[model samples]
Target: MANTPLIQTQGLTRNYPGVVALDHVDMDVKAGEVHVLFGENGAGKSTLISLLAGANTPSEGSILVEGKPVSFNSVSDAQAAGIFTVFQEFSLIPTMTVAENMFLGREPGIGPFTNHAEMRRKARALIDQLGFDVPVTAPVAQLSRAQQQMVEIAKAFHGTPKVLILDEPTASLTDREVDHLFKTILKLREQGVAIIYISHRIHEFERIADRVTVLRDGAYVGTTAMDDTDEATLVEMMAGRAIKDIYPEIPHNPAEVLLEIDRLTSRGVRGATLAARRGEVLGMAGLVGSGKSRIFRAVMGLQPTRGGTVTWKGSDITNAPTRDVIGAGIYYLSPDRKSEGLDLAKSSWQNLNIDLMMGREARGAMIRPRALRTTAAGILETVELRESYRPKAVAQLSGGNQQKVLFAKSFGHDADLYIFDEPTVGVDMGTRAALYRLISDIAAAGKAVIVISSDLPEVLNLSHRVLVMAEGRVTAELTGDDRTEDNVLRNFFNETGETV
Candidate 1:
């Protein structure tokens, strides 16, 4: 390996009001090496990427490209300098075709019209190069989340960037899709392109990264060769302290059954049966599109069940209206916070207070703004959101912060049965801990909590009893001593009759 750097940053700093996003951080990326920056959410990873992508200018710092210091005025400047970034959010246009999104503003054009044939050919070639099997002519909106992510990658590659920065690239990808991405990344490295990979799953880094860089609280911690560091060490460095156990054990007395779903069937899905006792934390785990989310939507009245019975506290509530479901102290928090869980245009206070503003909670049909503000503040504090962010738009806060606001909204109302679909999807360790504590507290308060996630570790750690679902049916149930990761994976593949 050579000592020459492809990209370098010195004394980088950025501040946002009360928060110091980045503080005098220095980083180096070498040609042909996959360098991973390890940090939790809000650990300056996104801010640093924004700076690299030229989406934001640094308040203080110097960035050097190809061993020469250069100031980037905009994203175009960064692209011209051989830098491309894939952020956590998908950037593809929903209404456009995959080929169209791939080229976008750089589509091939003749003297007066777009050369659609040429554009599609290039798009198909790029997809082939990346080993992605999606059709280039398909509408982007019709593709799954993982396929949309592939289009984002294809877009970055179309720019022919020498240095690629992927932020949480596999957050929404399935296991097979992740393997495909790894293959593409390795090909990029072979071509002498410097790749900066950032992710929460530290274990996956060892598969591709040459060296690992750790950052904590906007400051540089240390960098170590992948061979020299274990997952525990990397986690400790990223967190700035020892977290002996990722999940804190919270004890609760099991009571009578609080929720029962008998033969909960939707079209093309089977009898999805599940139950949760009062004060119980039930975990549902499965692969993507395994009918996990559909079951959740059915319970929340967001989808119509073909045939089933849902009983809450011994009362038949299947196929009930959403408002009636909420009235019965059963509410749901979705995985996609930006879309379903929040109103992006509304203020944080309004998002927090809207539920209360409905019906008589508004004090005889007139919403009490003062009371709403008070209540919002209290809930914001409950989820540990900054007080200053209360008046800002829900879109202004970071992903993890937005999620906190969602949690605050859920807790604002006294819901007995809480269905959290991918509750900690994009959250980091610190925020995730806070979330687990909040869930435990809610359940300890005698409410039933059902957590559905694709992450095995989360299900094993947080669930009192783990139920593995596959093909829209319950495959295996584990409790007490049988909920280990290895055990869960074994059950997942064994019962599903498939290989990982």
Candidate 2:
């Protein structure tokens, strides 16, 4: 008899009102293998996972576990069948302790009575086993994002799941934390656990994936052994077209400095001074907690500056409120799109119209709904965002599509300077190309742009000049011959004797 697959889906499909999220998709996961799912946002990766995890009922298809058909009407049903998923959006209760959050619904207890000490003991043991330093009794809200992610991982492993699904698990993790996660995943594979991994970071496939599956436009494109496929092939499969260049050329004729920061000091930034000019892209690079984001936050007036001077177009706006900063033709895009950037519950058109409607032009005016819809349609078209998704809640769109909406909102205003923090964090290659072109277009039009990213190649390729930050300070500023990854890393680590 042939070896039975751990989990299998036959002719699976899902459909929204006007969109086929998934279509006749067939997939299989084998025990002791890392099966990776690669696709552009909206290609149905999340939809398929939702069906398998019992979060959604498929329109048509069947799922089998170990060659036996099964139905999962709820998340608990999937868990009972030894399937667990750590979704991108965490499910932990922030106010609860780590131990309580881990064993949330099912606690160690006598009938109708909970055992707090036993829960803490088990949670602590799990954390230790995973090499994570998180207090079991501490509130989840007080922990950093990385620590909370560790808690999510620990929760997924609660019942020794037969099949584990991890979706963008390492997006917020540091390099060291990522290593720990990979080690744990390998151990799970050794224990014959079938793992379905989903991520947009292409660099991770070679490190962990055994077999690769590509999805495009809600259909299965193909599957290949990881070693047999190259990045170019994978990109083509995911995008359904060739993407020659991921980053556009940097602009050369930069105008006079439009924004200046002198001796800026904030909660997480210290004495950081930088200048951004029209027609220029100033890239900021640093590891997490190195204070890169703090600098941007201070500039956007989201954080108060202890001491500094912020001058824009010869006007001093130090420690100004966010509304005033935005009113003065400065736009800031936060990295956390779900909370800080876009309102998830609202439709795409509503979110896209926010900045425009807030402007002085729309003040005290009765903007027609038809006009708003027309304008939103035009903006979405310019960004290559699908018109079909324009009326849907932004939360229903894929990560890339939601990001496109955020981009549209930023451009909706007539801003002079644009600051984007990790704008392409969860976007795919195709959407990334579109975003790069948009940024380049903004610079070519003589508007200043600042790109703060953790992706080294992204900063190096897109920035006209690069700034390296370490411990709340700008260590090195590079342009021309001095701009390279090695130099950036050296400056990031505070290595001495490197030209700044």
Candidate 3:
């Protein structure tokens, strides 16, 4: 339980074919400290983590365990050395049960025969110990994102790791689930475990982090005690420049209604009512499973509506095909960017031209690569995505850059209404600023914009009016004097879950 270095890296470096992902970075974690790897996406935090976790070998420099040099050739080696990592992108197999996955590749038993009964009992005990109510026999694919994350954390505890690495542990969690996770972190710290935590949400640091290391563009900036630094200072280090503002002031000039939903009910949503007007930003706030996203998804034909009427500029378009909805000038950018927003295997530029590729704007014209490339480059420039990255596959880019590509894709369709759901979920502060400014610009340009987000500050700051949903319904609507945090949160758990 001594406050000594459990793991240390001296001049660690990692290189891909064309870029130095990590360049001579030095970092360390003490036996019981919650050390944060603070950085924007692509700032080399992941690279450094991959090296420490033994997922990727370092090109140069050395790792020291208890003051002795060692090389980790594989993830098994790192685990053997008492390091366990839960990556941001999940690696859980879809078909496996939670208990089976927890003991995967190392089931308990002698040689070949596995002890199934013991595995189930141990998995249940571990879940109970972690304070997560997950069914051990449930298939991981059937679980929600937050539950899956809990399972990942449970896997780390099963082996009693000396060092634990968590990447964006609360990105998809509800406020209640996040509270549980924080409690778990506090418990682990008391057990003298060294934790390397990564998150874009800086507010969580004040509560848990002992020390923080900042990385900017693949180089180490500095490390400081959490008590000695502020969020602004950390942001400056991560961006390598002073960011005076995070959210831009948006203009609101409400005009005619562009879209309206009357008594909308989908799979998880019920009796939701809302409207989008031109020249304004409509913000929706809710806990997970609250039906905020489902309301919009139903409008786009992705979710079937059991009862509702969607009117587009005075035309009934309820249950319309997604193509017809898009054709009607309503562009919906899904929150799941990897699956619904972009083609990961395609180049950034190609992903940006979904409108043209699907004939939303092509309109039987001959496909011109040069023209598309020129247009895409211009749009990507506005979002601050570098020109060099245009030719690279989006899957190869960092989370922040991939989000920029997804945002840039909306420019292709000159839509009357734009729906951006969790637009800045996993991005850095710099990228978030750019996207916030862009959202403001879209509202100023006389287009109706709807922003659905879990970040309460984002919803309160950007929207002229806010709608709060809980348990498949809209519980409250706030405007002007009613938009304070107290009012919003008070309605988040109203018993009725009915229309305001």
> 1-500 in candidate 3: lDDT tens per residue?
56568899999999889999999998889888899998988889899989999999999999987677879999899999999999888888879999999999879985689998899999999888777878999999999777898888888778878899999988877777778778888888899899999998888999899999999888999999999999889988888666568888899899999999999989988898989999999999988788899999999999899997999999999999998898788889888788688999998877888765554453446667888777777888999999888899999888989999988888887788999999999888888888999999999999999999988888998999999998889999999988988988898887585696
- lDDT of candidates 1 onward, in order: 0.83, 0.88, 0.88
lDDT of 1 by residue, 1-500 (tens): 55889999999999889879999899999989999988887788988989999999998999999889988889889999999999887788889999999888898999788999999999999898877778999999999777888888888988887899998888877777788889989988999899999887766887899999888888899989998888778878877556655677867677999888887897534787878888889998888767777887887788888898999889999889887887777879989888688998887788878776652352345666787677778778889988877788988887788889889888666777888999988777777878888888888888888899987878888899988777777778889998888777766653453221
Q: What would you estimate as the lDDT of candidate 2?
A: 0.88
Candidate 3 lDDT at 399 equals 91
Question: Which is better, 1 or 2, measured by TM-score?
Answer: 1
RMSD of each: 3.0, 2.9, 2.4
Enumerate residue pairs that collide in model 1.
Answer: none
Clashes of each: 0, 0, 0
- Residue 35, model 2: lDDT of 94
lDDT of 3: 0.88
Question: In model 1, which range of ten residues has the least summed lDDT?
Answer: 491-500
